[model samples]
Target: MSETRTGIETNPFDRDHYDYSSWFFWVEASEEQKAEQLAQQEQFLRVRPDSSIGERCFISPLAAIQVETLTLGRSSYISGHAYLTGTLLTGPNCTINPFCVIRGNIRLGHSVRIGAHTSMLAFNHTITDPDLPVFKQPTSQRGITIGDDVWIGSHVMVLDGITIGDRAVVGAGSIVTKDVPAGAIVAGNPATVRKWRVPELAPPTAASVPSSGPVPSGGPVSSGGPVPSGDPALAEQLRAFDQMVREQAEEVLARSWDAATGRYVDAPGHAPSVRAHCDAIEVAAYLTGDVPSQLSREEHVAWLRGLQDPASGMIAELDASGHPGPRVTDLSVDDAHYHVLCVGYALEVLGSSLPHPIHAVDELGADGVIALLDSLPWRGSPWRSSNVADMLGTAVLWNTRAGTPHSAATAAGLFGWLHTHVDPRTGMWGADDPRSGRLETVNGFYRTARGSFAQFGLPLPHPERVVDTVLAHAQDARYFAADRQNACNVLDVAHPLWLAGRMSDYRQQEIRQVAARLLADALSHWRPGEGFAFAADSGTGRDPLAETPGLRGTEMWLAIVWYLADLLGVSRSLSYRPAGVHRPEPAGSLTSQ
Candidate 1:
């Protein structure tokens, strides 16, 4: 008999219909025939009554799960027609639906649900070679790790090596490529955080949720909507300071960004700094209105596009006009990582505007950015605190927006490793140098690390200790190398001050006073007509420093102080008071290349 005569005619060649459940649709059968089918399914089952499954756990007769490598807690069930392989573990009350292909090393916390048609694989292929077929490529066997109470929706693809945190929901059809922070509600092709799941005990407020504005740009200031924190006085200050900063930033843009050449100028006698160009474009796009008339968005997009190596998402370290250059060999893993972030930020700022569609800045989108991040060199050790912090922070931000599943466990693991190196008294992790033992004194890096942890929703083991160290340092006259304002001290001072305002309730008042004093000390160096000087004593505090009419670094500092003040003063939602949004701190100048 023809298959169509026996059942609904379905193409056997369809990959989508190949799961174990396809048996049912392949033939239409009467009730008596269905009973025989069920019996046959049960007879073919590999699971024994003595298997690891607990009492009251239901495995549908039609399901085909490999019993030997699987372990299920009490009351957990696998829906019918699912094909599962590899070492799988699930806690109590878990529900895995049919047509799911879950394989390799996988773990699910209690009350987890693996929706129908969801596919999660634990390994990936390396296709870097041009000559070889992809299947012939080397494979990487990194597993998937999921936390308790997670809800994965149907049609979701949880890629290899990704981690989904507890209480997190993977929206239907999201492609998770990186680690997801706990309690995040993410949805998209490359998942981005739609909102955070607040604890039941917490008061209802718009904390951590994006403000309804022209578009969601991550910063203290809301360009179109109501100011996030409703403080009229601070709002006034922010407006005045934001205007000043915009003007100075515009000046930098005019001088640095050459529309014709698509290159940012550098200090005399060297290549135009690729890093500087990207940083300026990102900050400019962020600070300026969605469609600023000063420069064409298309031009900026074209410039960024020129830098990309299409085959690989790697951005060149030098522009066409740049000389004495950073050839491909000179491009370090660190440079690539930072530039990728810069590009992502620019795209975010560009795409997030009202009425204006998310224009693709270059061939590279969020996925391209993820590719760059994934390509970073893995250094195993008591890992470098800075690298770990940077990677984790960047991953969190990217995953929150892109919906890519990076590993949350991987980030948490790195954080745990970082915790081991922390100075208990200072609450600061040490420098990257392995030899720097317990006695090594804290430096500016401590402040940056603290900020990264706070921004990324990671706890600073002992924040008060770090705050205390910062406060003590600011009180000393030697905080600035020679009482002259420099970028280093400005940032070192700004990070803690900003954190205190943004993170601490009781210490806000104290931190504000210190910040005011520091701001005053730095401002005194401003030579009205000449703008802020690099150094007043004519000493080079940072290498190759020079006096200039305008410096991007200095402008960044003044703008940050004003922005932080506004942020601290705003009457924030109760949600933000506990831990502020994951938005990048403006004074995170240390993050600059």
Candidate 2:
């Protein structure tokens, strides 16, 4: 076996070995230093009842293993050429192999084994300028704390400011850039959780159909097959309508694109919105096919690169010139949700080639986005409006689409969080914070929430109860204004219809009928030159509705059209964002295919 002079060696029959003599030089310790190390060891052993310093523990006579500020536990052994600084505390039976570099404050619990050639850096550089050298950049320090029974394998790089929890196993050659939970098995370039050392649960099985209860009456119950299109003429008409909407959507989206910056403008000469830009990409892709005009596609990519915020791992709004604008900090839940939605959509649309501002999402990919979400200040609330559900669901949907490992596991975690905050009586989200007032579910919350859940068909806790309450509200005359007029902003009607049709499995017949009625009413307004009118008055569908003229409500109106088409059985085109976006089937029958 090849061995260094300090007695650290490669395993028997392993010919490969690293020469540590040059960098791992042993400076001869003075008699005083030797006395100090021995004295400290003796004192530690005396004070710690369970501690033991094993016989013939290798402490090189010439090696610079600083004895001060380090507390050794029972039978703990550190091989030579391991440079350690600051205050380090090790538990009993800890084994630190050779060529391990540690700095700043560190705490290792019982039986922790740090493998060979590992580096645990507690201070990391902050690289703000690409032009400047990393060495010249400012540094931030956060100590490392490894819990008991943790095993970090060979050639691992643990970056600054993270904790490795108890019983965790960090795989060989991993780069640990984030905190790890207890009993996690992590690996990769920027280490992600491969699996949790958790108790296995029973696999999910198909839910049993209710044995004796009849489905609520209004519309027909699901046939457990494709929704049949009885009227082929209506199907053709709907297809033509969808095509027209796509064309109009394209024209509107084209105006939103800022070629120089690649960002989608909120309005003329206004700052670019993260949500709008991502949404525009999907619109462009769906309308023009996946391969948008090469120039437009390139510009879209540039917008993604320019809008990303490195510091917070968020994609922020940007000025017309491409400079980062207002952040999500202290923003409303709707605004903040939009920012997160933008990131998820980008990953879904751009896939692996998405740019990295600080290499946050790009470095660790989906895990990076998860980490960014974790850092945000948003909290669980049952009454906090449906945007919360949309945000959570979007993250889950996009992450799943990105082909990230353990996406289901991550999504389950978010769903659990959502479940805990739901109001038991109302079957909707309620405020979790005691000081916060009850916020009503309005302002497009129901549609957004319903659309989000419908996208992935993920299981939600107590789903039946929630569906019952929502249905009751939909049937109440007071809920839709005194006259219960379905005609309003086009989305008000189209949105609920899409939500109703897509979620038919869980919804009541009354809701579906209402949605169908609203959709028909909205469609009646579609005009040859003016397009779908924004509203319908007493028995008359008004084209170029007098309220809010000049393309007002046009953007959301197109979104509504897309959602309705999705319910009508259209293949989802890549030109739209996920979660809130739906796929249509069964044409006018409004059923999934």
Worst 10 residues of 1 by lDDT: 573-582
C-alpha lDDT (0 to 100) for residue 146 of candidate 2: 74
229: Cα error in model 2, Å:
1.1
What residue runs in model 1 are displaced by over 4 Å at the alpha carbon? 1-239, 247-249, 258-261, 266-271, 290-295, 305-314, 323-337, 352-412, 431-452, 481-483, 500-503, 521-546, 549-551, 567-593
- CA displacement after TM-score superposition, residue 547 of candidate 1 (Å): 3.6
Model 2 alpha-carbon drift over 4 Å, by segment:
1-225, 247-250, 257-263, 267-271, 291-294, 320-322, 326-336, 350-389, 392-413, 431-439, 442-456, 475-508, 524-559, 562-593
TM-score of each: 0.48, 0.45
How would you encode candidate 2's per-residue C-alpha lDDT over 117-152 as one tens digit per residue? Answer: 899986668697999999998654445667667799
* lDDT score, candidate 1: 0.48
Model 1 per-residue lDDT at 435: 51
User: With candidate 1 superimposed using the best TM-score fit, by how many Å does residue 189's alpha carbon deviate from the native?
Assistant: 34
